[model samples]
Target chain A: MVIKRKVAVVGAGMTLFRRRMLETGKELCFEAASMALESAGISMRDVDAVVLGSAPDAFDGVHMKGEYLLDGAGGVGKPYTRVFVGGGTGVFAPIAGWWHVASGLFDTCLVVCEEKMSSLHPHPQYAFWGIFDHTLERPLGVNLLWIFALEMRRYMHVYGISEEEIAHVAVKNKRNALDHPCAQLAAKITVEDVMRSEPIVWPIKRLDSSPPSDGAAAVVLASEDTARRICKEPVWIDGVGWSIDSAYWTDRELAYPAYLAEAARMAYRMAGIEEPRREIDVAEVYDPFSYKELHHLEGLGLADKGKAAEMTVAGVTARDGDMPVNPSGGLLGVGNPIAAAGMMKVCEVFWQLSGNAGKRQVKKDVRTGLAQAWGDLMQFSSVIIMRS
Target chain B: MKEGVVKKGQDIGVGRGIEPNPVGSKYAGIEVKESDLRDGRYMSIRYSAMFRYRWDTGIAVGRFLEGLRDGRIVGSRCNVCKRILVPPRVFCELDFAQIDDWVYVYDTGRVNTYSISYIDKQARRMSSPVIVAVVELDGASQGMGIMHLLGEVRPEDVYVGMRVKAVWRSREERKGAITDIVYFKPL
Candidate 1:
């Protein structure tokens, strides 16, 4: 809100999203961080600070994970910090990097987000059980899908929607992933395939969800003057916003994500975006589940309430369609490594805006783009708008 | 030959580098099978850590749990906002004022939302599905609900706005926990 130096995304890189990788979490961080530095044409000597984002130490099977990932994140001898807001940390981490540069404290910041869900024994979904109220909800034995399915069902019931319609988001995103080099679940499937897939929950089929993955993503954010000197075309961080709702998630309606809308409003207001549906050329929203892409689209006001599904069914969210969403295949198409998934969205937006997204680039001429993430039992949301 | 002659460029390490995939050829990573990992073929270390929490439920939750043990549903009233919260809290998060009093709410309410879960906390498949629901207590304010189980009905039969009542355990068998009420059954 006050006067400060500007920040620009000069480089971004990501490792392959997979179910299990030979490299450990710290090793994955090094891979992505080094690639990001190479892409920016700057070495670690140019980066003055490091900010890492990852979700659930339980998944990594480690504690004080920020400190653990420091060396691999290229923070061996620099101002280092770790930001965690559940799954929102990926995009939120960059907002932290932006702060370090915007505050004039650091000229260049290397932001890294990684998640090795493979460390979660049995399955990564089990780690989410700890997220519940240890006393109240845990004794009832609830899994993550229960809440997501309940919300999906409620959204369908309230709007008279159907599972068949929601399946189309998965269809679009997975197909879009066919063009993504980092995608883990990229496949060409029909809505019928989605409908026929094994049911995890009544409304959520197996194919409708993103796979738990091991991966890492990194980005280099530099101050305006540094960006001008290092790169010819730097993607400016136009505005950033984040918000959290009451932790009493069950006490609120599941049909809409009010927190995300609040976050979007904060970001749009800061970016001076009066009409998001028109002004923002593209968006890379968090879509761990297929319905979520549609849900966030509505929350971002890119589509009206209960209209996102209709728009998706009409091919309005396709790469070639108007206001394309998840052009990098989203989390559903790409794998979900929690924090890395959100960071990948930021990279996707940066790529889309810079005209560097090869096969997944949108047909529309992109200028201003928005990226958002939601997590922590639907409590926290991080939104960022960028321009080239 | 009495002595062995070594080559100049000796290669001993396994050449299992990153795999080649036409789908995403540019991205780099390594992969292994589950078989190799399960039988100690892959050198690794494993251990377990135990954590037990003695959480203090504090004022509102302590009273709320006490109410559950008494076979009653209770909510706290924020005097300023006058909103009755079912899963009660001490201070009004919005008003930042202490809640005035605890009020008893009906055990019967409509199912605000429900889900049929087939997996347990460990992500293991259950033999039969469990119906979980968010019951909006009758006397509680709109959308103020708690996560609980639903019973005595099929998953397809469960719907939003379906009237339901809590099936509580015997008073003598009750503990001051949420499980005091087994599950909610449709009316």
Candidate 2:
């Protein structure tokens, strides 16, 4: 892939993840976008274009959430675009901003992702019912937990992986979140706690999942010239890749995420990374569920198939380990605001690369890192590789 | 004296200026308690979608539904792949070719995977849990499964490969839908 102009992330900012925020989605976007602009030492007047990402309008009870959030994202008169790929929208937003800068069409772009899950009635999980097949699956009175529980069960059944092994991911990530100011469920809990928690669905204890949250995150992307001129330590976007699998998720093997592997391979190839495990310093793989972190790690080629749990048990994925994963605690601890959660991963990688992550910084001097997010009926994945 | 003091534009909109919000202390959002929403401390408007519409099940699933009404499970086969798809499709996803034939699959199938859901569709905790499973029917292609409920088996007794047969509802209660069969019970 020949490049027109290199794109780099100059600044990143995010709001604290919470269960119920009085602020509207537009307000959340404004807070995040303003902080990002301030961190970049630039004003909204300097922004050439804007890219916004938010998950389902059903959650916000507002249709056309992107257009509703445009002004808050500093997109009043500039070229604006809204990109949503389910939960992958957060990372996909930056990938869109990368396009505007890398195409030489815009010198500076502001990327913002926001989600207000609290506005939905009954419960946020209720909104997911619309995602299923109304005829084939909905008639079964399906709940979202059924799919994740089934997937987690299949992954365990296939690899002979025990629920105890998966519980360690939640324990590790929650403990790691203690230093995060924006963390929602950060804690120091044992695997026994996870095992003893109420079973929302068999094989899926309450503690094994991230809580629904309301938050927003933003990052500023600039061209090579703009990055060098304005910021001292801009994180260059080394590679970006996204892919979607067949929509019929039930027909595919639940134990492995083939779509994520295809996306990771595309990114690794573009970044010229032959050995992901050895070359990449850290990763913030999506972990909406504890098993998902392991699932995604295997899919990203950071660990061998079905061996991620074993690696986690061996202290290989700890913040102090050789390859730290989710050093910012991840969605499991920070919270899952859908689109914002994915964007938070990208912001974490940017912060980690710039050495701006204060107490959440890993032990190693990381030069290169990767951030990945999965969404859309267990079918879509977006990957971004960055280097300081 | 108070009536004679007519000073215009002297403190008009003075204190409504924007206050600088420090990143660490006072962030942008306000956290409201759930009770606040209930007590009407914050104004909220209720809106419900009136999306009443019919969805065309199309030829493949349309025929499949008709077959279910007649006490038979129908599937379409792509001769290129030589596999019958349950919840049949008109076009082969992999082969990208038109289906060659439609076949009748068995009412009995093995459980591919199952979940004991403690919550209902509205995310409300249920008094009795529902046992949902992906049953890979016999006479269908390998790994092709349909999601349905399980009955006549203890949740603790359910296993991954348990063979189960559909327990059809009464003929008078039968609707040309996937729910025509009440639930799958242990064979």
Candidate 2 residue-wise lDDT, A1-388, digit = tens: 7779989999888988889886788889999998899999999999999999998888877789888998888889899989999988888899999999999999999999999998777899888998898778888899889988888988888888999999999999999999888889999999999999988888889999999999999999999999999999999998888999887776778899988999999888988899999999999999999999999999999999899999999999999999999999999999998889999999999999999888999999999999999888888999999999
Q: How do the residues B1-187 of candidate 2 rate in per-residue lDDT, one tens digit apiece?
A: 1233456865433122223444565346666678877877665677777678698999998999888889999999998989889889899988999985999999999988888899987888999999988899999988888889999999999988899999987777778889998899999
Interface RMSD of 1: 1.2
Candidate with top TM-score is: 1
Per residue, candidate 1 scores C-alpha lDDT tens digits across A1-388 of: 7839989999999999988887888989998998899989999999999999999999877999998888899998899999999989999999999999999999999999999998777888888999998779999998899889888888888888889999999999999999998889999999999999987866788899999999999999999999999988799998888999898888888888888899999888888899999898988998988889888898889999989999999998899998898999999988999999999999999899889999999999999999899899877899999999
lDDT of 1 at A266: 86
Off by over 4 Å in 2: B1-23, B38-41
For each candidate in the order shown, give its overall lDDT on alpha carbons: 0.89, 0.89
